[model samples]
Target: MNFIAKQMDILHHKADWFTHIVKLSPRFLLALLIIPVLGGLIAVILPAFGWAPALNQYTIGLEGFRALWQTPGLSTMMLLSVATGLVSTLLAFVMTLLILAAFFNTAWLDYIQRILSPILVIPHAAAAIAIGFIIAPSGMLSRLISPWLSGWELSPAGIFPHDPWGISIILGLTLKELPFLLLMALGILAQPEFGKKLREQHKVALNLGYYPMTAFFKVILPNLYPLLRLPILAVLAYASASVEMPLILGPNTPPTLAVAIMHWFNDVDLTLRIKASAGALLQLILTGCILVLWLAGETAIKYSFRDKLTNGKRAYNSAFWQKTTYILTILVISFILLALIGLIMWSVAGFWRFPSVIPEQFVLSHFQSASVQMVNPLFNTLTIGIISTIFSILLTLLCLESEQLNSKPISNFTSLIIYLPLLVPSIAFLFGLVWLQQLANNSSAYISVVFSHVLFVLPYVFLSLAASYRRLDRRFSHVAASLGAKPFKVFLQIKLPQLFAPILIATALGLAISFGQYLPTLLVGGGRIATITTEAVTLANGASRRTSAVYAIIQMALPLIGFILAWLLPKLFYKSAHR
Candidate 1:
């Protein structure tokens, strides 16, 4: 009886609290929007299980499952997907460590950031295309060095670009994912006391006679791992299920599973859509399994190293290895620079053929031609990207502030939503959206495309804003309230001023994300729209390499512009404020 009375009192307290809040602020209205979000999830989940009566499938069974299981090359494709994802992730982790160890306190960091941001903003599809153009036997690399150095023609048998073993795909993804990981790690390592902590950890390991890199691996990396886990998982999800990069860089005989799913979805045979949906569900399952493997590996590494650190031993100690690592780091950075240069060369090349170190002819013609015909799509991309980024930034700031006010956990839910599109096969949710689109009969507009971009853009905005939000001083808000400012007024007056730098950064990052979207644009815009990214992907599907490179350059341009805005906005604003 006492327990029942306690529960009743708790209920009464909750009801009173809810009534108070519901009457207090208009911001509470945002909670009502979640209903549509949940409804969308339910609509997809039902059809995903073969329960859609609209498709004349009233009954549920494992037939779709059986079909997905028996798809040709399914197992090999799954393995390849997993391998590519894992290898790219592992390489990115190691590369980030190497760069940090080598350049953490050095002047090299600024130069590295300058060179990398442009490369990072280059779309995945564009990277794949650039790499494909360079590494193919008949590609530019062979044309430049092959017969002169090796005394052989650039032959068709020189299968380096889309090699059967999927190494090229892994390499392409690694190159693309590395810059992002490095950028994310920059924000993390820039936090207060991180440098002091890393330096302290280094001293301790050095006193124990461990090499600096080894010290990082043994101590600093473990601490960094948990901080980095979400971005790593997000990358793994992308490498596994990416459609564009794999399509350009993967094996021709049997493409990556993501590509295969796309083919199944687009196949003229209507029933194949069922198989595609099943494959999407399987992709989700595979993503979950790989995440488990990743976590298990993380645990194993932790346990394996915990005792070594507890004792006075360095398991990774090697001065010679450290020297070699330094050399390798230089080489990798050089190669990435080379890749960026190659992209620039291709963007400007007019009639450069293979075996020429320089373009036989250079012209401004490509850019001019691309610009003239490309204006409409470019306008669409910028408008959508800018609008969506603005919306995402506004919503993210409000949500973060709301979460802060309510003392609720914010990171996990926002991170999950942001990374969801990256990790799961895009074809799955996109396919589910087809029915929603059919119902609305209004999927092919700039509005729908921008909405899809928002889904991708929100998480990045949230992720970028999170650290600033968490580390923010709460005293300012309290003081503002004490001064008789309302919560909204306090946010505008107190929070916004302090967060201007981060807000601008997040908005620019969000714009870059929206500008780079390919599948969502394609899926939602229904070919009635043409962003540079979508146009690049489509042009690459044909035999016109020249025209494709033109689009690729345009695709790279918008993000470069966004990154410049991100980089310069704070400096300009801060200088003006100080003045």
Candidate 2:
């Protein structure tokens, strides 16, 4: 009897400890995310004004800004950054709305989702490299049409993939960001209550003599845009200051402001750090201006369309618009597919001259040679991705569970906090973070890199898991409680099992985000640690095409394998449970 009573007491004590940890999770997560950003910004602000103690420059001045202003091609770099960001974002937003307008509430929507879902796992760097391979002057498309169609025995001489106008950068950003915005919209539409209301509204408009597309634009879009605003803004910020994509596909003469900032930061002269910090701040300001312009454009369009929205005149010639949407969708998907094919072909090509439809021969030497060099980077990539993803999932689950225990949802302020990492330009604050890391004298590059990854990865993991976590039926929990199960046990056994699929999916997404990280890994690791993305980006810049393609393929394959496992594991678990 004494032993039984002691066991009960110990269980109760453990339960209390678990509850405390759950309650503390929210505060811990907020601090973990918010502190680094705040600290990094402070660090950058000081250095930008030329007050770096490490360099023994204690006096503050505007010398950094002055140097930044006089830098050659500064104006061109700034223009390219703004133009590429805004154009890509606008194109992606328009494409997303058109695709949603044409396919929402139809079986076609499901088909489209399945087809594009895998694209999410393709990292931005890998996608950029693939697109480069497809559209370069000597790329696959040129080879396909060379001797036969273009009547040329040589690859075409045209500006692309490194075009001075940054068109290739815009194309790469648009293609990669389109899937993200589309998926976010789809998730919102997938909500049972909201989706049903939208479908009913569309039906009501149809009965009132509205064309399907017209009805969607008039009735559905206004309601949808509010929910999509945050995501759209996030896309704008990222595209405006992106590093990896620009590094691979952007022009070198005066690369985008973000890439130029990275170059300045890495230059051999330590004085360049001050200029880089100044450039980082300017990049931040430029991104802010672009976002402001976008918002103003939104306001103007809203007023301009206010009357037309309620004019009661339906668009009658919907067939052409619908056909246009279909064709555009097909073209986008085809480009992505062809890019993948190009990567595969280059990975195995053997000394084929240009204008040839196919390589003269195929060889495995690229893969065999690259494998030896890839081992350490591959291991480091997996280590960082796995550790960071696990931490993100655990924290996300705790925060959600705490919400359940308290019977309250997170506030608007907290939502903004959750999105802070996404909304802020990475290049803006990451340098500040490196400065702080050095000041603290912490030398574990691996730990620093993993922690840095968590800041970015946590937001994505939470966004992915929160909806499913909240939508889970509460009845199961109540029944378990009535059967005398403790809260922790219920969470571990009942809730977790029910949420296995979503958790796995979120885990895969977190891994994808981690795998794609370039700036965070490079800056935080202090150039001591290399990952697949870093290796891939380095090779894509100057190495042989065949070798770059091999790394790109491997980089893409990692996340895809994670997604595949996420899909397969849930089915196997449920089947066995039934058995």
Candidate 3:
């Protein structure tokens, strides 16, 4: 009887400890996300005013801002950044809405999702390189039509990718962002309760003599747009301050403000660091301004279209819009497919000249040579991705589990916190983070890089898993508890197994986001550690297209492998469990 009583006490202690830990998870998560960003911003703000003790400039003067203002082509850079960001975000958002309107509540949505999933996994740098290859002067598109249709023996001298107006940058950003927004929209629409309500509303509109497309626009979009606003703002922020795609596809003479800031930060002159800090702050302001402008535009449109919305029009040429949406969808998909094919072709071709639709001879030398060079970068990529993703998954699970145990939904402020990393420009805070690291005399670049990745990765993992975690039935846990299972034991043995698929999917997403990180790895790693993304971006700027293709392929393959495993492991686990 004493032994039995002692065992019961031990179990009670364990349960108490588990409950305490779960209750504290939310606070821990909020701190983990908020502290770094706040610290980085403070560091940058100090340096921008010339108060950097590391550089022995103790005077808090406006020297950095003075130099930044005097910089040549500053206006052009700012204009380009704002224009490209606004245009690309608008295009991607519109395209996403069109696709959603055309395919909502239909079987085509699933097919579209499956087709675009791979593109979603492809890293931004890799996508830029692939698109650059397809659109360059001596690219596959020019080659396919040369000497026959265009009647040009030599490669065309067109300013395709590096055009002075930053058109290619806009195109590349649109392509990369469209898939993300579309997938996010699809995920929201796939939810059972909200989706059913929207479907029923849409049906009611249709029965009231409204055209399908018009009905979707009037009935579904108003409800959907509010949910999608945050993601759109995040996309706008990223597009405004993007470094990777712009560096590869944008003009060099007067690059976008973000690219120019990166150059200043990397310049050999130490004083440029101050200017870079100033530029970073300016970037933050610029992003804020653009977001404000977008909001104002939204308000304007809402008032302007208030009459049309309630005018009781059903079929105002909905067919034409539907056809246009269909055509745009095909074009976007085809471009992505062709860009991928171009990357594969470039990775294998040997001495292939222009105007050849197919390579004259395929060689393994590029892959062979690149494999030897890729060893370190590939290892670093896997190490960082795996460690960061694991931390993200664990933290996400804890936060979600805490929510479940507490029976509380996430607050709006917490939702904003989850998106803070994405909504803020990376260049703005990352430089400040590096300063903090240096000030603290922290030299562990590997650990720093992994932690930086977690800041970005945790949000995505949490967003991906939160819905699935909350939707989980509670009866299983109740039954397990009734059978004398502890809370932790029920979570491990029952909840985890049931939530395996979503956890794996979230893990894959975390890995993909980590793999695609170029600026974070570059800034936090302090140029000491290299990843596949960094190597690919470096090679994309060089003369060797084959080498660039090789690195891009390897970079893309890592995320693809993660997604494949995520898809397969769940099926295998379920099959074995059944057997």
Candidate 1 overall Cα lDDT vs. reference? 0.73
Q: How well does candidate 3 score on lDDT at residue 391?
A: 91
Rate residue 447 of model 2 by lDDT: 94
lDDT of each: 0.73, 0.91, 0.90
Residue by residue across 37-142, what tens digits does model 1's lDDT show?
3444455566656776556776777677788888778888888888888888889878877887656556777788776767777888888888877786767656
- Residue-level lDDT tens digits of model 2 in 1-579: 444543443354354867789989999988988889888888988999999876788889999999999999999999999999999999999999999988867899888889888888898999999999999988888887887888878777889888999999999999998988999999998889998899899999989998888999999999899999999999999999999998999999989999998998888898999999999999989999998999999999999999989899889578899999999999999999999998998999998889875789999999999999999999999999999999999999999998877778877888889988888898988989988887788899999999999999999999999999999887677666656677788899999988999999999999999999999998889888999999999999999999999999999999999999999999999999999
TM-score of each model, in listed order: 0.87, 0.96, 0.97
lDDT for position 261 in model 3? 90
**Best of the two (1, 2) by lDDT:** 2
**Higher-lDDT candidate among 1 and 3?**
3
Question: Clash number for every model?
Answer: 2, 0, 0
TM-score of 1: 0.87
Which parts of model 2 are misplaced by more than 4 Å? 1-15
Which residue pairs in model 3 clash with each other?
none
Per-candidate RMSD, Å: 5.7, 3.6, 3.2
Model 2 accuracy (lDDT, Cα)? 0.91
Candidate order by TM-score, decreasing, is: 3, 2, 1
Residue 117 local lDDT, model 2 = 88
